[model samples]
Target: MPHPAAEHSAQETVPQAAPPPAPLPAPAPSLYDPPELNPGAWQRAGRRLLAKTIAEFAYEEILVPVRRPTTASSPVTDAPVHRAAAHENPSDPYAEYTLALDAPGERGAPREPGAPTGGGTLSGPGTPSVHGAPDRHGGATGSVGTGALPSRDGAGEPRDRAERPHLSFRARRSAYGHWEVEPDSLLLVEDGAAPAPFTDPLGFLTRARTVLGLDGATLGHLVRELSATLAADARLEHTGLPGSALAELDYAHLEGHQTGHPWIVLNKGRMGFSASDAARWAPEGRTEARLPWIAVRSALATYRGVPGLDTAEQLYARELDAPVRESFDAALRDRGLEPTAYLYLPVHPWQWDGTVLPLFAASVAAQDIVPLPSDGDHRLPQQSIRTFLNVSRPERHTVKLPLSILNTLVWRGLPTRRTVAAPAVTAWVHGLRDADPFLSEECRVVLLGEVASVAVEHPLYDGLDEVPYQYKELLGAIWREPLGSRLDAGERARTLASLIHVDPAGRAFVAELVRRSGLAPEVWLRRLFSALLPPLLRFLYRYGTVFSPHGENAIVVFDEQDVPVRLAVKDFVDDVNLSAQALPEHEGMPEDVRRVLLTESPDFLPQFIHSGLFVGVFRYLAPLFREQLGVDDAVFWSLVRSEVLTHQARFPELKERYELFDLLTPRIDRLCLNRNRLHLDGYRDRSERPHAAVHGTVPNPLHAL
Candidate 1:
């Protein structure tokens, strides 16, 4: 979806009389020969994904690698020493590691010294090989290492070097004990063979399958997901714009350029989508279409909205133009149906064709559900895949429809109960923000409320709690406030996730913004933290409320000069959680909201910030700033800690609350996103949604400060 921060030009939002309905665009020719599936693009995508897999898998403790000792050996006094010996210095945080894996196939014979390995090239000392494209930050992709021995015994002798294959890379352990592996430095050495560049993610997964504890079935599905992800990555790489160009686009258009979730290894594992389906519907597809509306019998459908949208009529009056509403009413009348007997909502074309029609065929045949023509407003799909932005009418509410594809961790479907209670939840949260001076005046945080919703429960699955959760969430739509309408004239918005994005040329997007802002990197970053943290902290410490402000949910609003000024958050019904302790602040929470919203202990509530923002987004962003802006990762984290402390100092009265929801504990549980896919959930269908698995504890950087 559009970066939550994108704003519309003044001319685009100017008032105009409603015109004739625009005709739907004709279907394009089939994508039989997709151009982005080239070998070069695929290989580059594979290398980058492989590096991510190794780093994330290692962090989750799913595939542990032994740290290789960095012993210095002089070239003149002895033979040429391993370059990793530089890591022996106390000031050097980098370390060498080796991961041994079961050999996949017959080992090849040893090749001639200094000969080119089949897969990729090896670099000499001081000059590391960069695999794919030219990286602006020099080593952003990674730096190749000298051909170091894979492993050694206690006696310093090579241990069965010819027996199995092993991967060696240089990495640095940062705050929270996070491993930052250099992608270009990855080298794979086989039995008595030369070290080749490890560029094949699929091969790496297969070779390390046993080590990763993947079962046969899980491994097969995992491969398909990873492959699909790689294809999407390749497409992004093929069509990606420079960071400078991306910065100039409006929020709705910018969403099309974003790479998917930063932490999930299979971020784009859109399981239910075919190649063609993805090309037309995926966020990266960047295509806009008019969504077809459907009428569900009032008996089977439930509508909820905030105060002004108390009834469906009010929402339809604002959302649908006069002619469109007349046409929809005519459609219902033609079927001998009373318009008042049905609830109208938009359905994603893909969802209508692939899910609703087939699964709810009986309802369609019985006239319980009827399809209507599009409202004629063309919307672009946002990064969320299911949510759509109204490019045709910037002032219109963004529509979020239930898309039954399995992506990232769960089915991309709205939970039935959550959907029905969405507006109530929004009303309660909006009440909290509006009543608090700190949130309303000081921070001025934009809470893009889910103002209205229509939930259509399945005829059979809605009652079957034992069935997979997706079935209960088959058809629904949520109307959210448009970010464009919420922004000031000179301001633009971008998702917090966009801050960590790196373009195909390895140029960091943040760097571009920093350069444009004409401010020091540190200053720009401090402004960012200042904008994001205060509001989130106020909600957590004083109100016992938290939103999962991970990259996608938390948006950074920038001023004319591109400096971050405020935060904008969305996805309230799904992401907002409260404390189980029942604070006074929650006294005003509506019954429907209290029942539907999940609650965690005060101690675990901070994890929504720790895991969602710190570990999830900033963990990756810290390393990027260090490499791209010459800022130290330690300093990068220190700025974050300072922001928290500053907020805490601003509210001395909430000292007890700060202690109760401690964010500065020495260590926090390592919420493993990748592990959930590999071990915990593993493509299994369940009655409930899956959650991130906690593998171990990680050092909290804020604690060090």
Candidate 2:
């Protein structure tokens, strides 16, 4: 029996004559690789990234660089570096770079007698180093080739501090009162001093091994990750579009240009990607490839959806128009398969050839999995490597598939439990938002619901205990509602990540948006805070719920003038967290919703806001505003405090919840993500997903405000 179709869908409004897919190379040419990966491009990208790696690691307490006052007698090197004071000085051959440390570890002090003068130690739990290619058990890959894992010039040579042009040496008293700068740390000091246009991230990491206190294994792995990051940065730099130009691009195009998570230093280290794969599939590559869809036997796969979607046919009808649906069904029939017996889903082309073909060979040979022609809809990869934007049909839903690459801290695969529960969780969250008049009527906050999902269990790994999670999560897809059609006239949307983006010209994207808004910098900042904070605060206090409103998860909606007006949130099933303390608001939540949503204590609940939003985002944005807009740090933070206080005053009835989820603690838990990568896991697979390492604490900048 033919399934009844919905009257209409978002596709109805799509313009006639859809853009044809761009011509492909005979053997599938890379979008932009040859020119972007040039030596000069890699050098510029490496230098800038190396400076950031040092600054961020220091800020996070992963590396402790003892600060001493700078003096006129500070030994200077002939190595050219961008001076701190002039960030955008045209005469300076490099971009704005700052040297935060003063003198090296104390000079002329006993350096353990024959100890070489590098600098200081970055010490940690001394794990033994693994050399050469990492074993399958996740030791370390030897090097990333041109991505700069090892110094192309040479490796492991002990160059003294006095001889290195970028390094300056001065001894500081150690815990035992003897002064000596390790040879490795001395190189780090030089790199920071003469950074930008002349820095090497991989080389710096190798030299700083003693100071970093990293064992051979950790240092070698870190170098590889940094190298991959440099390669991505090089591609981004070669885009040649300033933030202003990037701003003018549509939402999908603009997403491809983002610089990625500001806090994670190794943000773009897609470990599984070769240089060719990175060029074709990585977001910064800006390649729009047609996706290949597959049909899986229903008996071998499970799917769940919200109220409106009850069957595979309903989902297909809602997502694809009548003509497209018929074409898909006919194609399945042509392959001598019963269309009704199989569920159709989009596959990431890379995954189709790499993991799926090898792991699911048995299923394919048995005719349980059948391939369909490319959908012909051009799609661009988003910042999250596995998710894709439907560029050919702008109003269509974004499709997310599992890519089994280990990036940042975890394998980039969707958990089967979460994938199956996504739609139901989305429904529960949407109901809560719609029930609140303020969220719906006043704020018009959009919840980009995950409408449907399919999870295919691995034949061998599904029921096995203690197997690496990557196997179980190997095959799945989620379809989320797009944000395009939801926007009102003259309104524009941008991810919160874009706000911190700085162009090659040293102009910030936020600064440009503010200039276009014609509002004073401080006033513009208040508007942004007002747009983003209230709904999030209300979710915590009124609904006993919170979201990981980090840069990518939270979107700022702007009006015709580019002044921020409202907030839009996404990534619900995986990121939304509920208060462990049961409240009246959650009484109606479905069992599946309860099972899938993470529950956190109210005391730690504010981290979703404090760490994800304030620290993750404002920690970086505040400084950018201070430098580019002349809004001092104090002033920038005061505006943020004002927004929180105003929200509190508006809902006095929820004052108890506000106190319970306090955001103004004197010190906040310093969650270290990189430390987790280096010390905790180090590219190894674990049964449980990785969590951020909480070192000690950072004095909360919001305290006492």
Candidate 3:
């Protein structure tokens, strides 16, 4: 309205020194706070970006090699690494640029020991191909045609992009804020291009590293986001995948997230990874690096034809000690995503060394993953990881060892079931030395007594060795303790005998098994029982019927030939008779003593007496079979039947006894089924107990199975 002061003052005051403007303090500055998000939200965002990259790559399988001399029409897109197979062109060193997965001297090797291709049509040598195929058709057996694979996709549609591989991206983020692909054939880089191996990935990584300048903390955050998205995709494919894969996956992403690091991994074949151009060499790269004997054994075993197991554990130790899924589960529980979380390991070069054994075998065998063995050293190869794993959930990581030794240290054996038992098991080392004499060098029987004793004495009271006498006594007091149920049989007899004897081989076998089972949970336990125990018992006693299904006896362990770690318990010399048997069962044993304190059960005697001794001892072990200890299950089973079980058919004395073997069963259910049926007269009341009915008929427990 410009009324009062304006009307009078405006006319004369326009020159009034701008009304002596009042001095004002500046408003508080924002201090540049970035956008707020939930804790670790940045990681989720990074995962989304990674997922997008993968999704896009999956759509474009037409590989555009940076230097493979491919037509420009299919020029390299966003794809990373590329290479041809070893046998593609012998004339060109770059031909063996693809992955090589054959073992040092196996069938698919450049020169396997007994190659039909190496030998010629009988008299001379076979013709060798330039690089496509080594002429091994020595037998002139002629080329066996494999015909093209019937496309899994619909009959007419172009090979679906979905069916193609997720384009490989071996990336490295550098200290200089650039990302670069570990290009295939380091020697094949375009002559004019600068740092071709690192150029492919530089675009995306450089922009972020230079502009965003995230710290390790920021890197971790973004990587996690990428990991989550991939895991979600895997969840649709497999359920066994664990959430822990995220740690590996995210870290793997970071490896490629940069391009210009001082050090870069260069592939040679698939057997080795060199820290070439590294700012700092790896710990294992130090002079005189030595792995444990068991680890060496495990590495060789990993060389067997098995995947993830072949190199996953080894690489995990070498490059990244990815945390177990359980650890992440606990973290996520504290955060919110329960159960559905997943984790993955990045496929870096460390994964190519001994760790890639099985993968190498599979790739070559199936013509899926190719081999590119080096012409000179024959080690250090480029590597590739399948975008997806079949197991839906990630494995639980609980080896409890440093990343450097995790694979060999995988927790196995019954020892790992509880914490208290660990100390007792540890304490047994002293006892191992004590009982070394009588056991087979492989049994590890010498150390068991000590282990058991320590378990009983353990401050935590771990009961591996304890008899639970309180419970036993309680049952003892409550019932007439069936003559065979309370005391008279050798329960821990095999263990006892092993403890007393000092056979180094026997002791070693058992010791390794127990230790590994504690870590691996007898994953092969039930099968080990079927393979070893039955044959041994069959060879022991021939006249009486007997069975050795004692709870502690049935066991399993690792059988890595390079480094075997068996899991089952052998025989028991350190046995105590828990109960006496009826006169009927012990009628005609060789040992003069009528009331013999034996291990396992009376039912097992007949098989041993009939053919076990004659066949197993006389025919099998006496001759010494080698494949029995190797990894082939068929080989294992063949030995079991042909060497041991077959002997039963040859022995005429066992026909009738064999019938008894068919009817016998362990009394595992007696406690639950007969608890009230048992009674004791004139005895103090104790924990209520059960009884056995001599006349009752029992159905075969295995029927449910």
Candidate 4:
């Protein structure tokens, strides 16, 4: 049973003859004529674009202080919430901070009146109105919110108390709780303060244009989103105000309270924050509380909506919106929401990636490079373009894909063939059209390598060259898959669990996933959670309340048993937030340290916990199992929680050693409490909801009361 051949294909480097390869076509004469790939261009552009984008968020999401919090104690870096004050009066001057109203309506009027509000509706059928707090089923407690359920400042404690800074804004939880801010958003600087316009709107907009290479309309959309955030802030302060003119008010200031609200909690499998009420609580970060990537990606998607950029992809791309509400609704109906919560959030937050590179290549690259595609879809269409560096390598169809399928994707259009010395070489290549400018370099490489398929008795080695690089770029680009790839999707995903490096069980588990799934789509997940397994269950981590999980990225493949046999995960668009790179503690942990250090980013995990697991796996995947398997929902979450805890009990060393998991335990509980009940007042009123001024029509978007 020991297969020496089981060694990963990447490690098998046998010296052989290097076959002569066909000459590559000349590079295009124009349009980035500089033959150099300028891969650095991506970094530079990405940096500049990021700064400008940050600038766009300057007043909205970005918090700048004239000085450190007068009261913040040193050493504790966590963003501290305002503590309770001895003298408490809800009607005091310090209680009038800004908060955005929940923008109204069901999905009916896709087009907001006049200019667009940069807000999209995510409410489902028969949504109850907010009384003071919000109530409905499937809602989770936490700052991110449950539905468009209400909860805000004072829901916790006092945040900041100041004379109306002449700038106040309102932020409402769009259907799935992706916060939408208003551009040209007003500000209320107390009675005497001056509400100034954003000083650097153009500077911000231009920078976004350069970094993202966005067209006019895309840029415009971003600006609108920016403005909306500002406006929403204004609305929040204005709506809550009950004071006199500037002359009458001196030290009188508003100190909004949202102290009691927990930032995260687990609801069944879904993650919810203060979904409904933003104006009262979480105003400082209200404008852009969406799943980190969703906020940006939605902006990009909207940018493509602008005319004249000559970008039709985003204009036509169908996006899944609002898995939060969808999941909640499904929960009510005894059904499961679709499997992609991160991909389907209802609100259209700002986005930029889709308008750029991988956004376009998602399908093209995916279809072209995927060998088996899925289980039975092995007879893939040759139409999927293949790019090759040289014909000396084997064609994708002829190559032994093994685990390299992922590598091929990372080093897209690169070679996979392992080379030795070439005694006699013969290969033909032609696809890099000079004048015709036919295919992307990606295509040219794959096509030419396919041609090299001829004249090599070593049929396998013939296409080796092109395959390795492609495999490296695509698959080797990241670390988690390789780690997970080595495990079995089924048989209790806990085989290696956290023992990926120290224990042989970990290695064996990795081997199974690698062999069976081969980096396919959603297949691994199904295989992972069928039973009480650690590594299998650990694979289900999803984060935060954004509705949709990233789709163009994560992929899975199931075998003949209709379970995940091969799986691959892609896209770190939100890697900055979700990755574990920041936690230096992670590097010392078990598993592939180099891969984790070199490829895995810690930033993405915080975000992933919010986006991928909270929305994707918890909200999406678990429900899928409940529906398909016909099981109770809470039992599913309880089972997994029990397994993880039980495992921790079994291995005390793991609890002491893996600090990451140490930080992981209680988060699910915190996220589940009061997350759904947040509203205008400090405590929630789940018993009573808003009653519309008019019975026939739905409650006004701002106040169902």
Candidate 5:
């Protein structure tokens, strides 16, 4: 058979009309400008991210920060006191400590230096609760530099003898003992550490390398990832959209504004993406590009769909209108191909040029894969880089294709096995939701099912167990039901990630929602907790299943009043896990389904909700609520605890299951995401995907309540 390109080239004819005037090249969008790449924004983002890294790492015991003694004479300065010179000799407990405090108009400045005149106790676990130390009255006291301290010099000068204030407290003890604090870099000083301001991530990591126990190789790679993360953060800062303005954006537009994964310091590190690629594909870029469709020969590709879409043609008909569908079919026929013999799949433009065209040259040359022109609506990238929402047709299914780009931990590709079984998996999950009265009638949680899918495995790599998993996952696409289709009148949907988004001016999207809803802060939060907690808790205890209800996977449905009404979840096949223990519920599950889904122990199941929802999101939002709404950290957690308790009470029959999948454990395993990148697997290809490293246990803030 003649090659498809050759057939098309033979039929091509020159334009009959006069050539149009030569047009100037279009200017590149600002998102392609290396994320502003300025010292001010980059360093600021780095320090903030470093602060999170220190807190979470220390919380996980990957790095332990010791407390330095503070006394009446030498009060905690508004800067980091270099204890390296003092503690350097290991044997020497005290040496001359140089305090690199924040100067006027810098972080950590202008306040009382000493502890309050009273007994001091440490705040309970997880990152230091210093930011909302309860006693701080929602003021910025507990963070690295939240405490008020008199300003020294911006150049790290010592305080004047005449301006020094009196020390109030004689002593205070905690896990991090009476540590003298500093500005810029959190109190991350250790023996032999050089005194410095929070300038750059690489510098901070270098100084604390010994303390962090990071090898040089790990540090180098981590710096690169952090550099990418900092650049993205700078871009977000440069957008200058306040939370209020951000809230006004459409769902797809709002996705572009979100700072991803609150806990992951290097969340935006699109390692394989060049600046140009990032501009065209990164969610932050907000570029709308039409994707071309490819017709893969049936012998080389496989597709599955729900009962309604029993055939690939049926799925295509529903996605594309009559005119567009005909155009796509005609394009294939013009290349001397029968449309019935091929499966149409939309391909990410970047994936085509970067991976498919070059890697699948044999298939293209053999005319097995025919590239068709983009005939449908333009789509916008979502927070998950590979997924795109149809902007022209809001009701159309969102398309997820295998991009083969290294992002977060794994390559952003759809696994062959998962892609093949996606529709079945969705059917099973949606079946449970539809059957359960609580889920179907009361909560009305929407499961945006992966209704159709196509998988074209690499002929060579598919059979190799030794090959990197990315290779096996490189060529597949999933079509998920759009959130817009499931919504009722006056309802809108937003990703859970948006709730915690705080803009450049430190205004939170949730706060804006609360203001718009005209509900009191505490009341509004209670409504949110009420909407999210019950349905998630019930799914675990009742069905022996759990979804990775992370920020991106979970969607919050809101009413016209801007109050959260219900939850909608997507990304099912890859993230949903079943219980390993035999449950009556699983007895009826299909054999093919059992082979593909992951089974986790009941103990580990709650982590999907705990680590994914609580620690992953609420941990960040708690402080924001404290600052914005005066809902004390303790009160905020109390509200969450109340919701969980209320749900447990409603389901008396699932008490045993609740106990088995305990959400109220005293210490839950701390899933260390960044640690996996830094130490466990440092930019090396692995046969399997990487997961969060459980370093140790952190105190579950919800345990007591």
Candidate 6:
């Protein structure tokens, strides 16, 4: 079969004359109504989000729910009983918990003197009341659960049914003190009233605002973000395919099916995107778009690339065809400007019209920034809304552009300093892998380098001190090495995030892959760990470096039979971090790379893997595996712990490094993702991007193993 790029190029070469412009279509009688917004879809999305809200909030110690004694009877009379585990072992991780909501304008029940005021006292068996003291058996263990609930009204009498609303559900505390709440098990009971399924995320948030410590302003913005997220979730639910079908998709198409960041409750809170914008540009939109190019004057634009792609011309030569280059030059020459005086880069259509035209009007008027027609390659947005994969030419570089919308946590924009230093950072990280025998030969880990970048500085914003970080990151483009060109023959790649994805029918993508591989679930899981952990472990212990191997940033490569084989990682400049203490491995690092990569102390350096992969990705994956594949959560965690130990044993000579960058510590700092948005950042614009909130420590499962 002819290559797709060849077909595209041949078609472009034979193009004759431009067609005449056509009139705009007539307006429809009614506005488009999205099918995904039906009540059924919303309720499903809401129930999931509500469960996530409760789980994440409880995990972060923001809303501590009191543990309730589990009885054989269902919490809700009509609702089906859901148990995390089938057997009722005394040491079983699952437990029942309840959170009470006071009536509007009424204060919570009075607390005993010296007891905590908000929730209550932690007095439940096997539930952790204090930080870093989780049960060794992979459950919350403590005799004293301080979180006590109020069953009575403020007038010291039992409140009416409607006046006393409380939520009850069964949840299991997994590794890293993670909470996995059974969404179907959640119920809202009002004293004398019959219990009903709790499916309203907004109502839950509104009712528990005081308990959650959310101020009015933050609560208002949070509600908006949550609603936006639910809408996106509904769309995914409406269109989601079964795992069997998803397993057959290519990397680019598979990305559209993924539910966003697993750890974030409001994962799709694209603050600046309208419904139309989302349909046109969101990853789940699954529409291919040709991004229009822009020419920024040399004075304001800076280009950076690795050794072979040292010049803008070199990058353009590889990224744009001759015809596209000539057309760009013709556009500049027609305006009486030299093409050499400008740097050409693609701009997202929405960003071009919404952000650039409005904010950088002065530059456009002065012809310092001139818009050019698209290079004519159709690209699909990946999980990261701002990144695009060129479907027209799969071998071409994937482009990451600045998008001034808030999602997950920060504005999805490339920072000026990091954008300019991307190539340098990539080169340094790639150099480390290339020089190491294990990474280069044995493991064969693929580092998808950000080979080139064009940083366009906003004239006024660049000069201003303490300007909003989003303004400083207004316009930039990073060209990353494509995944298609890096994989071995018969090897396919999927984002690590996809493994945790559960199809609307409750089938896990991992289970599908495992079944197709013809391997026992445990064997497939071991293969997954073996493929993922070694490279990451080497980077932290041997090289004193770590990449945030979070779901979105890491890609797992599978062989023809669907067995995981190797790892591919991207987003070098933003997600990579290094050790604060100087090591021999740092000797080859360039000054620019050193300045760009953030450094942490040796003690905290491992958090990138501990939090990013173990907690961020695997925390959720473990539960899904247990539920769908019947792999015990403890066994799943043990597999992960064994991988780390195996890697450590393989590098006995670097035993000292292992101690410095310890992964088997008794406790690890709890990095809170949802808490950052709810309590810390809360839609507020700051000069710098916000970091994850560090709450109390969580017991490390690896230590127990």
Supply the global lDDT for candidate 2: 0.71
The TM-score obtained by model 5 is: 0.80
Q: Quick one: ranking by lDDT, best first?
A: 6, 1, 2, 5, 4, 3
Return whichever of 2 and 5 wins on TM-score: 2
lDDT tens digits, residue span 586-654, model 4: 333323212222222222232333333433234333333333334344454455445456655655644
Q: List model 1 lDDT by residue over 280-306, tens digit each.
A: 999999999899999999999999999
Q: What lDDT would each prediction earn against the true structure? A: 0.81, 0.71, 0.24, 0.24, 0.70, 0.82
Minimal lDDT window, size 10, model 2: 143-152
Once superposed on the true structure, which residue ranges of model 5 sit more than 4 Å away at CA? 1-35, 70-196
> Candidate 3 deviates by what RMSD?
27.5
Tens digits of per-residue lDDT for model 5, 1-705:
899999898789665898898999898765535646777777666656665555554444343233334453754443322334221211223222222222223322222222111111112222321111232112211211121233443344655522322111111111111111122534333223443254455555554443344556666777777777777777777665887787778788899988888777678888878767776788888899898888899988999998898888888877877887788789878988898898889998788888888878899998888888785588999999999999998888999999887778778888898899999988888888888899999999898999999999787888899988888887778999988878999998899889888777667888889999999999999889988988888889998888888899989999999999999888967888888889998888877788899887788788888878887778767767866878876688788988988999987888899888898887666566766675557788989887666543455667774
**Per-residue alpha-carbon lDDT of candidate 3 for residues 572-603, written as tens digits (9 for 90 to 100):** 21221211234333343323122334333434
Better of 5 and 6 by TM-score: 6
Top lDDT hit:
6
TM-score of each: 0.86, 0.81, 0.20, 0.25, 0.80, 0.88
Give the distance in Å from residue 228's predicted Cα in candidate 4 to where it truly belongs.
22
| Residue-pair clash count for candidate 4 | 217
Clash counts for all predictions: 5, 27, 134, 217, 10, 13
